[model samples]
Target: MVLVAVLVVVVVVVLFAVVDLGPPHATTNKAAIPNRLR
Candidate 1:
């Protein structure tokens, strides 16, 4: 049971990270994201 819980948590975290790092092509301010991140 514990292992199953850990797997689910890891999967969710990975998905979140991927989505966060992906480019937001829908917006016109594509260059602004990296500047804000720095």
Candidate 2:
């Protein structure tokens, strides 16, 4: 029972870390936009 509890905690910690490293939103993108109008 103790081992299972530890395993669950470890998994939860890893998932939290993964969420922190997820892809950023549009505002976070630094690339400049191209204008199509001539």
lDDT of each: 0.70, 0.58
Q: Pick the candidate with the highest TM-score.
A: 1
Task: Write one digit per residue (lDDT tens) for candidate 1, span 1-38.
Answer: 99999999999987765576565454634565576578
**Candidate 2 C-alpha lDDT tens digits along 1-38:** 99999999999986764565445546532332222111
Deviation of model 2 at 6, angstroms: 0.1
lDDT accuracy of residue 20 in candidate 1 = 66
| Pairs that collide, model 2 | none
**Best candidate, lDDT:** 1
Model 1: clashing residue pairs?
A: none
How many pairs of residues collide in each model?
Answer: 0, 0
